[model samples]
Target chain A: SQQGEEDPQALSIQEGENATMNCSYKTSINNLQWYRQNSGRGLVHLILIRSNEREKHSGRLRVTLDTSKKSSSLLITASRAADTASYFCATGGQKLVFGQGTRLTINP
Target chain B: SAVISQKPSRDICQRGTSLTIQCQVDSQVTMMFWYRQQPGQSLTLIATANQGSEATYESGFVIDKFPISRPNLTFSTLTVSNMSPEDSSIYLCSVEINVRQYFGPGTRLTVL
Candidate 1:
């Protein structure tokens, strides 16, 4: 079964704007991770937030987890054209389960 | 972080034929995973391969269709059997290191 579902399947924004993508999962997880894929290539791990932690920050990326709602959101500040790619959210369980993903486009 | 490599980055095969994709990791790992990403879609895990054991497949997937082999901690392979056009997709292999998962470049398979 699919564990995560991301909304706003696609988003297009200006380079300096902030992009926010939300993900919701069904089951309890030890941690939730964010990944980025460019041009259908390999995935790059971004950040991971444990169930015990509500929020995490890495560079210009910010992740927030709400365990009660079984949801999480990733915020990329001052996005660049290079940030254009597919963003995926994965829930850690017996195995990693990926979300549908958000296709983000940054207009320069 | 683990540096992983996959063989035959892309291949074109006809229906009824099979293509075996190989994955090799720089560091020894206990578990390796195979995932499929259909055209314009998110990734779906095909199976989890553990060294010296049979692969555990997820629902909607079976060993017959996607046979996997994990001979050692650093190497694994997945073969797509009896291919069809629907089987065209990117197959990726990944391993977890320091609890964080890293992926290979992936094998792009196109079945005609």
Candidate 2:
């Protein structure tokens, strides 16, 4: 079974705007990781937030995790056209289960 | 970070034919995973391969349909047996190191 479910299956935004994607999981997890995949390419690891961490940031990316709610959110500040891709959230434990990613499009 | 490579970046196969995808990691890893991504769909875990043991497949996947071999820590192979049109998808291999995982460029398989 899929452990995570991302909201807003697709998102369209203009460059310089911020993009926010939310993910909800069904079970407890040691950590939650976000990944980005370009067209016809492999997935790239973006950021990881542990259950204990409520929020974390890296450059333009911000990840917030709410263990009590079993939900997480990823925010990309000043989105760029190059950021157009599928973003996935994975919950980690004995194994990592991926969600049906959110496809983000940044219009130039 | 570890570098992962997969052979036969893409292939077009006829139904009933079989294709084996190979994955090699630059560094040894205890845990490796295989995932399949259908067109416009989320990735699904196929199995977990560990060195020196049989691969453990997911609930929906079976050994007869997708046999996996992990001979050592750095290399593994997943074979699609008796393929059909429904088997068409991108097969990816990933290796876990510490807490982060690195993925290989997937193999795009088209079964006609």
Evaluated at residue A45, the lDDT of candidate 2 is: 93
Clashes of each: 0, 0
Model 1: C-alpha RMSD to truth?
A: 1.0
Docking quality class, candidate 1 = medium
Q: Each prediction's interface RMSD?
A: 1.3, 1.5
Against the true structure, what is model 1's DockQ? 0.70
B30-111: candidate 1 lDDT, tens digit per residue: 9999999999998999999999999999999999999999999999999999999999999999998877899999999999
Best by DockQ: 1
| True-structure RMSD, every candidate | 1.0, 1.0
> In model 2, how large is the Cα lDDT of residue B92?
95
Model 2: pairs clashing at backbone N, Cα or C within 3 Å? none
State in Å the error of residue B79, model 2: 0.3
Error of 1 at B32 (Å): 0.7
**What would the per-residue lDDT of candidate 2 be over residues A32-95, giving only the tens digit for each residue?**
9999999957899999898899999999999999999999999999999999999999986446
lDDT of 1 by residue, A1-108 (tens): 678689879999999999999999999889999999999999999999999999999999999999999999999999999999999999865378899999999999
